[model samples]
Target: MNKKYVLFAILPFALSACQSFPTHLKKNEAMIVETQSPDLLQTLSDYTWIYQSSEKLPPIVLDLDAQKRIFIKTGCNNLMGAWQFDGKQINTAPLAATQMLCPPEFMAQEHTAFQFFNQAQLNASINISNPVHPLLTLENKAGQKITFKGEIKPEAKYKSTGEVVFLEVSPNKKPCPTDNTQQCLQVKQVKYDKQGIQTQIDQSWQVLPVEIQGYQHNTKQSKIIRVKRFNTKPQTATPEYAYIYDMTIEEEVAPQK
Candidate 1:
């Protein structure tokens, strides 16, 4: 028996074992690195996400601000909080929300979502493997997962902050100031308190004939709605304020023609 031959036989086994362990470990490390990249955060920041887990509830919308703060809309109420991402792990601060009363179903959905986000060691992953439709996934310690589909928010596309306000739209469409032949919805600004009480209402009405981005007016009724107003650059000839309908507050029959 030669010592050199025995050493070579054992050497192959040691090398095989050494390689197997790291290869297994590298696969996991790569998976973690893939999700923790800053690009993932940038992808998330580019669009507002709509929660797709529940059909009965209104889609939840999220906007990440410049300061790393998150603004959330759970269909009926708004919430604000700080969020941070550290190597595939997602963490959130205590969230503050408006005290709006909503249906029991929506309230329950909101609470469940809040708990999911506050989980200490939640994991986040994005599926951009498909370009046309990107998905965001968040998984809690209990293995429960919430998924969201992304939609470009106005601020992301327009490159400006939108002023969020509420407007009461008149039932009757009055003659447009610019073009009398075309009738318009007489809109007035309305304000609400933290408790969702109507704090102030504008007495004067202004004619708005153009289509608002997120608002759909029903000719059969008048409505009080929340809207986002974006300001255009002064250099452009476009109208100063661009309005998008957010949500309807009150609905009533149209006034007699």
Candidate 2:
């Protein structure tokens, strides 16, 4: 047997073994793929990242929308910015923040977040060990880290962008139509056109069967509110649609009768 021929034959086997076993990859880093799926943004945008500093403190909310816009809530004022993920890192542009004075504890977290995210490009990692609950982490050059838990966005889970509906809520509650034992919201559907001008409204108020998320009507005031209407999952929900409060369009204290 020729020595050179034996060495050349063994080289191919060694290369194949190396290719089969990529020892360079760390177990924790396996999911941070170099070639991410084409719909990476869609996957990321589906979830909202939340940072809960403590059970007593309010959680910081970070949302990534389809327009490449980042919406952040820091317990006081909202922050808006742009963001991009380049395989190994997440880059956040300098944010445009609303200037509002908040409590010291709230502002302290806000300051920390500003230092972490404002105009910083960070190394990023995601742990999808459990699909039901995902984790996203960002690290700076100084080895400082911020970890956020992920929750599926309402729009993504519902599979619809949701319809915007206007509702006028009466200050008084009435007996529910379905359950006379329970009280219900007195509401009238208000209609609008593409220009957002009022087109029509229900003549009589109706007892609402479902509760509106994020709405707590004051007993002394009537309110006209904007809400996103989404269809509930069939067979699993009592109401066919769920309304989430978007904003209060109008409010007036009801005169004592």
Candidate 3:
């Protein structure tokens, strides 16, 4: 062999025989570190999480209850399911969703979200270094990650179970019976059976003086809305029934009187 080739061949063997070479090579081999587990059930319960980033659709809302129930609002459709959290892993059951035609973008976003939660196993982590602004991250075996930021809900803040009710709001805001100067929404309670069939609808409309927490009224359209009613103890000046809009069922213009 040529002198140069012999030197090169021996150099690699010599370096491999040195102890420092093993250490140097070990440094380059990547090591996979496992993530620490946190109290997932406690951290995830009761709060509502909104997706921080989305393509062209509205932010998705996620809610986890203490009863292991999961609720999701995917811009257009409402989904319900159950979730289980072991010490280190999380799993979700089959989710049922409302069948409503939505914009193509919204539907695509919903499909992506549904697939994320419907995964067989997911690893969850919560970063609470900043208590005021906590971050939740979920990772799957496929290396896909989804992050969410949460806000405490009104009922969750108070640690109370809210009464859920549905209301149909008239398209036009009529004058309040007590105060003609104040315009109010004409609303009526709608009742449903265990099977979710509409059992009763109050024909008489009542004037809703106060606005619903999450509802945005459209001046041109009526809405069938679901609301959560919370009663504050040691009643303050606030209304007896504090309403938070859950979802809108129908959007149509009410007949003008």
Best by lDDT: 2
As for candidate 2, its clashing pairs are none
Is candidate 2 or 3 superior in lDDT?
A: 2
Each model's lDDT: 0.67, 0.73, 0.67
Q: What's the candidate order when arranged by decreasing lDDT?
A: 2, 3, 1
Give the higher-TM-score candidate: 1 or 3: 3
Q: Candidate 1's residue-wise lDDT over 1-257, tens digit each?
A: 00111111111112221122212124455446546675776666877878855686788877654445666777766666655566666555556666779898888877876776542455888888775458878788889887888876677666777888888887667888789988878888877676666777788988885658867768878778778887766468875777877667677676666
How many clashes (backbone N, Cα, C below 3 Å) per candidate? 0, 0, 0
Candidate 2 Cα errors over 4 Å, as ranges: 1-35, 38-40, 192-199, 233-239
Relative to the unseen true structure, what is the C-alpha lDDT of residue 192 in candidate 2, on a scale of 0 to 100? 64
Worst 10 residues of 1 by lDDT: 1-10
Q: How many backbone overlaps does candidate 3 show?
A: 0
Off by over 4 Å in 1: 1-39, 75-79, 97-102, 129-133, 163-168, 174-209, 216-226, 231-235, 238-241, 246-257
The digit string of per-residue lDDT tens for model 2 on 175-213 reads 988888999899999876655566777899888889998
TM-score of each: 0.61, 0.73, 0.64
Cα-based RMSD of candidate 1? 20.6
